[model samples]
Target: MPQSNTPVRDRLEEILARLDARRDRERAYVKLYTESARAEADAADRRRQGGATLGPLDGKVVSIKDLFDVAGEPTLAGSIIRRNAPPATKDALVVKRLRDAGAVILGKTHMTEFAFTAVGLNPHYPVPGNATDENLIPGGSSSGAGVSAVEDTCDIAIGSDTGGSIRIPAALNGIVGFKPTASRIPLDGAFPLSPSLDSVGPLARTVTDCMLADAVMAGDPMASVVARPIAGLRIGVPQGRLLNDLAPEIAKAFADSLDRLARAGARIIDCRIDDLMERLWGATRIGSIAGLEASRIHADWLSDDAALADERVKGPLRRRLAVPDEAVAALLETRRALAVEMDERLSPYDLLALPTTPIAAVPIASVETDANEYDRVEGLLLRNCQVANQFDLTAITLPMPGQTRPAGLMLMGRNGADRMVMEAALSLEALLRNS
Candidate 1:
């Protein structure tokens, strides 16, 4: 919501200066599109001088997650194995849309290897540090995308969400992230983790920025989001295991957020969404959709040389290969049925609110050294966000107020209700800011 009268190129230079200053400590970008970005900024300035502008994001710096294609660059996707992969002949559809909107392409940000893990740990590349605490893990696979926005390297970060990649990093880094309904954004040219669940979205400082970026990426008309009256909004709080485990700080922060909403006239109702949760758990039981899809994509590469991948990823990849075909079929059927059930369940409420993650960001050292701890933390981090992905709902994570550790209050709406979700998020964000 902050506006600057400075020239686009000038502001970009200032951001570049800051990026250079912290280059040694932060690994937010795997590639820097300096020349192209400067050229784009100059063009934006020319457009402004001619009294013609692209839109709200014209001349804004935006970073892409490595999974998305950029012409002339190999999409490494945070993996050394893909270092020798062929360069993309053209930009991904979303990337092309960003360019068409007059956004300055900052560069491709780092991510988890093939976006396999929730905890952003890349043995091949320097792991991007947490925006809030360097000692903590930056939630990933879209690790650098979140850090790029938090660090002011870009105005917004374009990222993908399969199972909380965008929201987890946003929650951990204390930023805003939006995952629209899967069908809202085209996925052509993006490296897939799960064709069934992948959705392209943005991470930024405010819900407005995300709304603008989402519109641009989807090729939809830019529309203003008027915050709905909070007093009349019906918000459902799922009363189940989703709310069970919480770090003291996170639990307190979430409770206080709900209390603030209630005081502002929002009707907060405790509801049971057991059927929705059960379907999600069942669909993901045999092998993750992402893991299965990733296995198929990487079959030849893994077969040739397993040593190319990190040990942590190799184990999961192998397990995905062993899943029974019958199990996958059953899970897919359950997923289809549950998607409908979830929509019906959520139709009564404006939104469903939950803690973005059960715990705060874990120390990078803890997860890196202990595999068991990594598994436990990964599950906890992905649990709440993955529900939206499985049920095909649009979701957004808003940073919670008064938290010593970063925590996110997530708002989820019915599938294809992305605009509604964003408007509600704007209202909630305003309430939190005032409180």
Candidate 2:
């Protein structure tokens, strides 16, 4: 198993000390469970010292996204009006699973309001700076979870992905994030963004950490990821709109990574999926499936306290509130059709590979100050990875090799193939790291 070698108590203290530093406020933790976390760490350490049987996640420090229920506290889902919402009666399902596996729960991290935005700007809380560059935006809406994973605040960060929230931030922050098929991990205690599109997953510095948390959360019993051989692996590279408007750094790193894979004996095939994407996008023209679903989730709130939330979140969602019921029905039908088509389209290949984001993280000020920039960056950030959510596929994002600026190479597979994607990522991650 790939559990951390450091003592759990020491690791917890190190993270707590770092979080306590005033300058780290931009690191974006919304709340800290210091007392309970310390108790858990002590328990884990005692278990370790006693030569107890340990799960893969035993003694690992894990952070929860603010949207998950933690018992006795209302899940904010990055919204303000929920301050007085009734507290949850129990931990979220995934939270309970992680604890059962002996993970040390850290605390909840910040997020975009209602998990709506791609750029990690939460006007309601402290925004997390990019892990590598303070000036760059940490991708969202799993903003703080992403930061916690890369910044070593936690060994694993539990987050939700709807329309690329997990992969976008993982790519920008240069960590590994896995989005299992939406149904793989139960979502009962998570605050909904778009229930149809939402999947809870993990972000961490290594694919192993993500794989461990994923299995635990899904009630799977796997202890380690066996790296699949790169030789003869069929890797499909989708060509067209998903690859459009790439920043030079992203483009070069992607090209370089492909060269490495090809040289390592993987078969690289150029696949065309632009028409499929256009159809998917065309179907949701009234409002994105996420936007439409979110409209319904926030229906009551929009009628009463919409003005209290960030305009970026409430404005777009409010527009979707009036979408005719028929349009929503049609959209769901189209989503099912697209998922079937995508499943067939991906059948021939073991996996699909692409740059996770068209561009690297941009200056926080640029997106924060300009609505135009925010719109453009949000669309681009969500462009490639949203295909996975729309089609119900599984995916993982690993940092591209040898880049001064971080970029991610995302690998995606058909629905219900979460473990297949992880096995491939195990080998691919090794290949990328060596390069």
lDDT of 2: 0.89
1-435 in candidate 1: lDDT tens per residue? 225466888988887888788778658898888888999999998998898988988988899999998888788878887888899999999999999999999888989988888999989887787988888999998999999899888999999999999999999999999999999999998999888889999999999999999999999996575776788889999998899888988888889999999998989998889867876676687788778777777777665553678877787787887887677778777888888988998888989999999998989999998989999999999999998998889999999988887889999999988998898899889988888
lDDT of 2 by residue, 279-353 (tens): 988988899999999999888878766269988878888899999988899899988988899899889999999
Q: Any runs in candidate 1 off by more than 4 Å, and if so which?
A: 24-26
The 0-to-1 C-alpha lDDT of every candidate, in the order given, reads: 0.89, 0.89
Question: Residue 325 in model 1: shift from native, Å?
Answer: 3.5
Rate residue 59 of model 1 by lDDT. 88
Report RMSD for candidate 1: 1.5
RMSD of each candidate?
A: 1.5, 1.6
Q: List the residue pairs that clash in candidate 2.
A: none
